[model samples]
Target: MDALIEKLKGQIIEQLNLVEVKPADIKPDAPLFGEGLGLDSIDALELIVLLEKHYGIKIQNPADGKKIFESVRTMAEFIKSNGKD
Candidate 1:
């Protein structure tokens, strides 16, 4: 899980183009799409695609998207449980 989290952090940093932040700077439980990391709706869409593209996990329901994207920890857990990797 730790390895997966680190890899996902790197992917997030690259995909989001988070110029000012480092992977280690991201708290696992940090709010990734708002006050904590300051991402917006478009970034959320990117993250959703990222989960599908990289992890081979598709979130069909928008409501499930909320639970899946709450934080890095949550995303990691989702991927770990459901990812093709």
Candidate 2:
């Protein structure tokens, strides 16, 4: 799980084009949106693309993204639960 989270931090930075953010800078439990990463709606769309492109996991319900993307940990958990990792 820790490895997945670390991999996710790099993937998130790359996917979101967060040039100023490093993988080490992202906390596992940090929120991906709002006050945490300051990501907006468009970034959320990018994340969905990231999951599909990298993990082969398609998010069927947009509403579930809010919970799944709560943090890197949550995202990793979702991916693992879906047997994507």
Candidate 3:
């Protein structure tokens, strides 16, 4: 799980072109949007694509994204539960 979270930080930074954020800078429990990473709607779309392209996990419902993308830990858990990790 820790490994997955670490990998996710790197993937997110690259996918979203967040050159300022390093893997160590993203806390596992920190929010990915709003005040945390300050990611907007477009970043969310990129995250969806990231999951599909890298983990082969497609979010069935758009509403689920809010929960799944709560934090690196949650995203990693979602991928793991979906058998993508």
lDDT to native, each model: 0.84, 0.92, 0.91
Query: How far out, in Å, is residue 13 in model 2?
Result: 0.4
Task: State TM-scores per candidate.
Answer: 0.89, 0.96, 0.95
True lDDT of residue 58, candidate 2: 89
Q: In candidate 1, where is summed lDDT lowest over 10 consecutive residues? A: 76-85
Better of 1 and 2 by TM-score: 2
- Which digits, one per residue and each the tens of the lDDT, describe model 2 over residues 16-78? 989999888898998888785779999998899999999999888888899999999999999
- Candidate 2 has what TM-score? 0.96
lDDT of model 1 at residue 63?
A: 66
Expressed as tens digits, the lDDT of each residue in 1-85 for candidate 1 is 8888888899998899998899988988887777867898888888988987887777787568778888898889988787454
Q: Where in model 1 is the C-alpha error above 4 Å?
A: none
What's the CA error at residue 59 for candidate 2, in Å?
0.7
| All models, RMSD in angstroms | 1.3, 0.8, 0.8
Error of 2 at 75 (Å): 0.2
